[model samples]
Target: MTSERASPRRRDTWIVLAAALLARLAVVAWAASRFPPTADGTFYHRIAERVAAGLGYTWLWPDGVVTYAAHYPVGYPALLGGAYAIFGAHPGVAMTLNALLGALAAVAVHRLAARAAPPGAALAAGLLAALHPGLVAYTPALMSEGVTASLVACAAWAAAWVRDAVPLGARRTIAARTALLGVVVGLATLVRPQSLVFAPLFALLALAPLAGPRARRATLGFAALATACALAVCAPWTIRNCERMNRCALVSVNGGWNLLIGADPASTGAWSPIKVPDACREVWDEAGKDACFGRAATLYITEHPGAWLSLVPRKLAATFDYCGAAGWYLHESNGAACGDRCKLGLGVVETVYERGVLGLALLGLARASAESRARRIATRAVVGVGLVFLFLVHAWVAYAALVVAALFGGRTLLRGPVLPAAAVTVLGATLLTHAVFFGAGRYGLVTFPLLAGMAGLVLAGFRTRA
Candidate 1:
């Protein structure tokens, strides 16, 4: 019948999309049943309930007592609240939404990888992302990681589109894509303020190919648009905070404090167990006696600069150690923790066993020798993000682990058309950073998608070679 002929590309995309959706649904169901509620989940869940009950952006205790002391951003809770409005405050519904977003993220990754590599590579990347254990675990939780990851992936995809579409002599398409990129980045910032780090980088990267007089103007315009969108989304909470607390903070006020805690000798090291007053005072000069716990950490860092310098390696190690294991890194033992004691069980052991020693060794070597173009680009981005966190936040093992994972994971994913050099560098970075710092399992989740993508690429290459 000469009815309708679907293009091969369209058909392939639809098939991949359908498959991704099914896989995500399965992950959502598994996550819903397999994992118990986590600490952050409880916090976000309760916050969402409060939001649903018209508490607005104000944090409150279960007893209806107002508490602005909580350090979390409002994006995830607000999303959960919207879900609660429709689904009646059920955690499962909220999780289902996360699962959906995660699936969307897989789709985005697939498109990006496919454009950069090949269709098969894209499909493999999408499948890996959908089935990623780390992502699966967080998909149904009340936490923001899954949603944030999705947002990041979406932003990356948007950036890729802007980059590719502009060069193909599509000016109109470029403008629209750039606008969408701005919107996506803005949305990502709302979810996690840290995403601001990538906004400028992406803008600069996107403008690289644009010619002469138009490039600068386009870049500036896009940057301004992105900033405006971000401010629009975040300004309400900032205004509310200013009116209520006289603090004109656009984001949360916990960055300095987190940095102080992460860099403090007393806290980052052995003194982590002890609750010392004035922990944050040195870095934040305005800190008072009651705020001494926060100042004290800063004071230690300032007074013992040499000691702190020496401790950097250790801090890096600790950041990558078991301590970075997402919610499991918490010291307290609970059903929600991200450690072996938590509901998820020992994920580190599981990863190690699943990956195997030989595979791990090969990955390690690959990461060490990642000197190629793709590896450099991905590593630079990872390093830039890591540096931002290191300077602005606290240098933790988890952060180190995150950087390594990104670097290695990106290399691994790209290794099919390329060699294993990038992967090796990423692994080396992760191990060295972890060895010198600290780590936790959850902290490693950020790179899980990359790892899965890399594994798929490696497998595909082996099959091809064989």
Candidate 2:
């Protein structure tokens, strides 16, 4: 009897997935050994412990009072809590989960890239995502980035599939896919409420007359059904917030805090401790303080429109500047254990990998923009030189590269093919969401998979053979 053999493309796909999983697991183990839970990790761990202990989602104060908290989104901690319940509350458990999620994220990126490119290109994209330093490094942290990244990529993929399925006239398939898209968006919003906007944003795109007047009504139906399903998924959480928090919070209560951090006169366009205004000094409750901060931030923004406007570039800078989330978080959590040299080395590795991929993505955008072969070559050469010069000029390369990529991605979303269009939509939403609140390297990790996919797509476009 002769055994059937797998095709080279199939083998390549498996290799990509295996490499992604192994890379993430190895990094998770290394990071687990080096860093202890700190900052947001501390909060997630403690909350998860409380959840595992059946204490609800309350934080035990220094005085031993148990007060329910919603300062952060409950999705990550609640998920962590479930894992702790099964495996015993441990940081390693969280890190392992993150590694698994990161692996799945790599798959999502590969699938997403495949929508617009060949199998070879898609596999390359998956490999890039699998080995991405930022994604792998962050696996050890008990943060929501892991969950958010995976969900965001899945959402983008699902949305793109829905877009693709529209022309097929498969009513049942469209409905099922639409519901799945809603579910993905709902889960994503639970982790990062800013993602709640995705449903409406995509729905608006669906509602557009681009498909002509005949398909317009069907697309409207799709949009409404998706919006309803998403709302249904999130309804329980919103109801819980209303009943328990005494305020109807859609997800978490940190929006005001984040907005205040980005809008205040003392704001540095990044994460910082929220300083209560005199008007909010008496507001001690989380919900109340959230409202107070919201009003205060609004006041500041209105009073100093120019100042608030100036912070936009700074916010983008903070969001995209040098990818070193893993190194920075580990260093901050336990620098004494890892030492400064190791931390710096990790930072250099992450930064170099980030810049390289980002530069290639920008070059891909440049190549795609030009019509003729000579023009494409000229554009690529010019962009290549400019990018290198920018890197040498200062750390501005990170900021510049990201900003340009985002702009080009936005343009692609408008006039490009469906697959790449969907990818850019996710990227645009992420950057725009953070632009309104604050920016941080960790927050941007949520989009690293998509970024890698974009770069992979570019590389594939240049490949002569599959």
Candidate 3:
């Protein structure tokens, strides 16, 4: 780790990246042949097509219903729109771009590992991300996951530098690092608003590593500057939403509607579509419906707190099932609805991916923590084992108890080890957010880079004690 004895850094990095890209391209080719882009992507493609044609982001129906777009984020479509503009609405081109993004994401993961631990670990992390099965398969899809993953990885790498290195660097250096973090995170947020959550959370956690007399001021300064830049980056979208929609929409209107989706009376907290009540549709526009749905969700949760709590375990189950049944790893082919067998097969794939690949990342992170004495992962280990046991026994209460204990017991660890804390916080936030609203397998994809970096640390091992 001190210096790679066997190979040069750039050579290793490119090797990892090239291999990852090749694998992704191969997977993209196979998937493109076997599966078509699903509905989730169909809308993105339609909007991109509309935009490419100079029609603006608008949708029209036969019933004289004219709607302006406010449902999804603009960034991914904007990327697709650019591709369409150049190549003219080709799915192959889009998939190729997605694969390219996934490869770049692998590079980001490599840098993240190198920053957090030793340089030797970087290639391992990159390789883990490159070969990650779900990551490879998702590369061919029209979903935002590929773009969001790449951005999040780059942001995470920048954030690691800000949190782990900036406090010790020069004054201007700190500012530059913080601003860069902001720029990357802001871009990621445009792709998926969930990226915004990391700014505040990581800022708060950044306070952990600053230890000098000036640590407090430095922490506050870093947080304030980073957050300011992020908010500034999002200003254009916020202003556009407000001016156009006649409402102050900081991001897409999907949050409230998503909240409502999870708060349904019959909701199990998994991603299931329910028919909107006529009352919900009384308001014509998505903005109005989102507001109405938010209120309805709030009312439902208030009136049925017990029901909400009951769904927590199910949601948590789905969220952390790793590759089990929920979270962001759910693989649907061609956006077509799957029968029970395919759903079950996807669950098995996720389980395999989570246990095998994610477990590698977890192990790598633990090793990194151990090598750097970053922060202990004893509590994290317990939680991992608990989840595995839960998978076997299907005893939600047992795993819930373990998770709660880990949350309380792990604070000391979280306070010291920045990457582990970041990783755990990401997993916790993703799981809790989805459980509170609704979850799909892809929701868990956001944490992939962090895990890969940790896995890299493990591979780096004890600095080959001279």
Candidate 4:
């Protein structure tokens, strides 16, 4: 009898997922036509072309000099280069790879959700991932969003499996899980260096809760294993940078430049090169340029702490929503080359995904174990519809309400407060990083899986009890 019921729901879930994938493919095709590959896509493609020609991660300028790049990490270009080598240097090849990554990311979302939440919530999260506008917008591009999100999704899944699905007692089990997360994070950092921060954050979230001397020993072992694995993963690139560039850049040289951009007086606290000091621009080499920018940024922050403090709000606003006025750019601008209907469709999808689905998920995240099917359904529908509609009509109140509800709503269940706490921590950590450094919705996209896990687990009391 239980199998019969589960069989139908599983069938329905697949149907939704399949339809979502088809829709995403359609989106990718449409996007390819309307959007000529630009920005990071164009740069990545150039680097891939160079690499394919045995140039070894280089770029040829208009003046005809072959120069290597260190600002952007080489992992993404390497992926593109391999794809070009196999598929013959066509735009479609990379986009197709991106499409595959997007689909896999959706599947990872489902798996991660299942471990953290109930079946219904997992299904909902999967469907949402399939249709999310941000994922749709960037995944087709030759940018790092799809790849980074895919890797992060894998980490989230491993974290969930270790924490909620499997009991954690043995040091070996803990080390294995920590190492898995470290490898994923290290690979992601190769694509986007900032991802390195998550390795320590994830380790702490995973290992900090256990009690007693044995638990402490296991936690130490877990941290050591994770650190060793992450550093080992980064070793090749670090050595290459040290040898080839004669610098200590572990991942890339963009960090200092990015910080300078975010900290300058004329920067408006978002993304801007306008305030980068002239001396920094005079530096020709990547290492020298980064050093110049780092010095400039430090001087500014030291001299004018008030200015730095004020920029935090601007950074935050630009982080969540790209502040074009401050020149914080997005890969694809909203409604660019898209029709009114397309704009409306994208807007509605993004709004619903970020606020609506996410809001309900937060409100339901801490549900108690004993609940009837009718109550569960009611809770889901009422919370979801109400929050979504309010968010659509009035974003500020709805969003504030989301934060408040996530923090204060729902009854405590038998499960430890790990999931919710970790969700908050991940989101908080991402926000804090961007708020202090630079801000773009794209930059903070790592939080999506964490949010999905939290939301998918909401109101899952009936399934848990059963």
Candidate 5:
């Protein structure tokens, strides 16, 4: 009798897994059909192909056209290049790898949610994550966002599990698990340096449940080990950048440009040359300007105090504005050529117009409620750590805010006494930072799985109450 029941349960589990896998594959196929090769896709894919074809990493193409001069990190191209070499240089193969990574990310989300909530809520979270439109849009592209996001999700899951292990008095096991989390985080940083922001936040979140001298010492020791491990993995790339360019830059030369673009007085999708005073522009344009862009932006802000002050609120609004549009707007010498047919149409525009008011209100209320719950010292510490890293690195305040709101909603759903408050606090910190900087739809993707899990918890509660 027991064996028969267990066999049926096992079969049901397999069926569910198969269904989830199929759902993700179907989304990947649909995305592959909809969007052709984007400009970024063309650049990354071509470079990967070149790398696979035995072209040295630093060689410039003819007529001053450069292919691999550090526009992005080497990890993603290297991964895609290896894929191309093994499976023939096909876009489909590269996209398939991304789809697989995204699907694995869903699994990781399921594991994390399951640890916190019931099995039903966990399944719902996984399904919602699989169906999220933003994830759907980006997973098949050759861009690093989908893969990087997946890595981060995995790292977060590993970190959370490590935390769970540590509290259960498993010191050696926790140390091993935490080290693994560090390795995952290191790889994530290699794919996109921005993920380094999560390192300190993870440390704080991990240490929250521990107390006493022994726990503190263990926490510190484990954190140091993890940091050393991450640094060891990252050291090679850092050394390569320094040797190749004679500049000791750890990551890409895009942070300043990103900050300038995010804070600039341009429309949603626009790009412009970095403009400082003549002397400052020259100084800031040098390879060493990666460290100077912040100073230059600060100087710009100081000089145009009123204009800079006004940009804060404007940037906040821009971050949340869902025009449902796509891509950067480029200008031709002759006239403004609105390239690409992905522009918002009547239906998309109307949807945005209708939903804007309600979405904003719900978002605000959710954020406020989360903040109120996060008033404790521990929660404050988490928010502080995340915010400091966010301000120093990127400036997508609106995206941050939306994540916080969604987290608040998630916490509200779970009814767990502790995590909801912390989740909401992190969300608030994300929003406040986003408001001061900029936002993007892709940046908000990280929080959706958590939010979806939270939403599932909420719906379950409603059903139970009804």
Candidate 6:
């Protein structure tokens, strides 16, 4: 009976995966002609070309000065360089790679949802992920969000498997899953070092329970092992930074600069140019500049606590206000070539899709907490009203509701299923991380799959109960 139930769902999952790949490939095909790698994409492409040519990760100034650079995390460019080496530095190669990563993320979401929900819900989560507007739109941008987001989903799935393995008491299986979790997180950290924050959080939230001392011990052991493995994977990058950049940076050299950007009074809580403080003007080395910026930002925060705190809401707003990554990238890269109608249509689609998903996710979390039919119906009515208001009346009210809902849902899910709990924690962590540094619509793309999975789980629960 179990096999009978699983067979159809398995096949459907494959079909969903194929649809996701095809959809992304279609965008890639269009992007090949329309999107010509602009801004950050240009930076990644040039660096990748140099890397493919066997010139280490160095930046070439227009004046012809080549300097050793580590401003951005090396993982994405390095991955692109490896592909460029084999495929001759074509933009299509990067797009195709993103499609594959995006598809993997969908499957990872399926596995994650399956941990707590029925197989049908798991497939729904996978389907949602495969077709997520933001994920599909980001494929042509040559950005790290694709790789980082997919890695996040994969890491979450691996962590869920580790949680499942702990109850089985098979030491080898547990050890292997923990090791795999570490490796996935380690790679994720390479792409986006903030990923290190997720490793232990996922461990405690997913594995630790109020059950017994034995479970607590397993959680601690798992956290320690996964953290150690992730650090081990990053050891080489750290060593290279120490040797090449004269600084033992763990992952990247932009941390201090980013911090200062958010802390500066002139900041609008988004990406702004870093103004070198008086103390850091003389610093020439990347590591030294980063450290100097760090101190300056700390001083600013210490001196102006109120002002720095005020930026938190603004930062979050910048991160989640709207979603049009594909359109944004296309316009940035091709400008008028994207056409006004194309731009307007993409904007509307991105906004409606993002808002709908967010509303559904909020509803799912509410469903997870609803214990009685009365409460469930009330929750649904409130959510329905909120969505209607969000579309027709006011957005701020809806967004405020989402913030409150997330806080409440996160508290409730701490004792719920490991998969959903971990997913919520990731969402919380993303918000917190962006609040500290800076925020961008693209930065939150990493959470799309997790959000879809959570929504799928609750919707599935609703169906089962009905």
Best by TM-score: 6
lDDT of each candidate versus the true structure: 0.54, 0.74, 0.66, 0.63, 0.54, 0.78
Angstrom error of the Cα, residue 313, model 2: value is 1.7
TM-scores of all predicted structures: 0.70, 0.89, 0.84, 0.81, 0.73, 0.91
For candidate 4, write residues 1-466 as lDDT tens digits. 2887567557646754685568667866765555555666788888888778778876678998866667788888888898988887876777777777777766766665554455676677676666666666555567776677677666655555556423536656766778887888788888877777667666655655566797767666666676677778989988888876657788888877788778866666556654657776677887778878888888888999998878886776665543121011122433466556654555555655667545644465325332455545554444454465454443323333334443333232223444444455556665667767877656656666555545556634422221
Which order, best to worst by TM-score? 6, 2, 3, 4, 5, 1
Instruction: Give the distance in Å from residue 63's predicted Cα in candidate 2 to where it truly belongs.
Output: 1.3
Per-structure clash totals for the candidates:
66, 0, 16, 4, 11, 0
Q: State which candidate, 1 or 2, has the greater TM-score.
A: 2
| Candidate with more favorable, higher lDDT: 2 or 5 | 2
User: Which lDDT tens digits does candidate 6 get at residues 241-331?
Assistant: 8998988899989899999999978788789888989999999998889989999999999999999999887787777776567778887
Q: What is the C-alpha RMSD of each candidate to the true structure, in Å?
A: 7.8, 4.0, 4.4, 5.8, 7.4, 3.1
lDDT of the structure predicted as candidate 5: 0.54
For 1-466, candidate 5 gives per-residue lDDT tens digits of 2776446444434443455456656745655444545646776777788788877455466787653356567668878888988997877777788777877776666666555555565566556556555554445567776787677667767767776775478777877877787787788777877666555455545655676798777777877767666666778888877776556666565565556555555524333455553444556233556546656666666677676556665554444334221233111111122234433342244233223322332333333333344533333343344344333323233335434444434433223322232234334444555554455544434444444434444443412110
Candidate 6 stretches with Cα past 4 Å from truth are 370-412, 459-466
**Ten contiguous residues minimizing lDDT sum, candidate 2:** 1-10
> Could you give candidate 1's per-residue lDDT for residues 394-459 as a string of tens digits?
434224434453445442333322212222323444444333333334444444444454455544
Candidate 2 per-residue C-alpha lDDT over 370-418 given as tens digits, one digit per residue, 9 for 90 to 100: 3456555654555565477447623334434444444433433343444
lDDT measured at residue 47 in model 2 versus the true structure, 0 to 100: 96
Tell me the tens digit of each residue's lDDT in model 3 across 347-450: 56655654554444444333333322322455456546654654463433333433343354444534554554566666666666766887655666776655
At residue 427, candidate 5 shows an lDDT of 44
Error of 3 at 242 (Å): 1.0
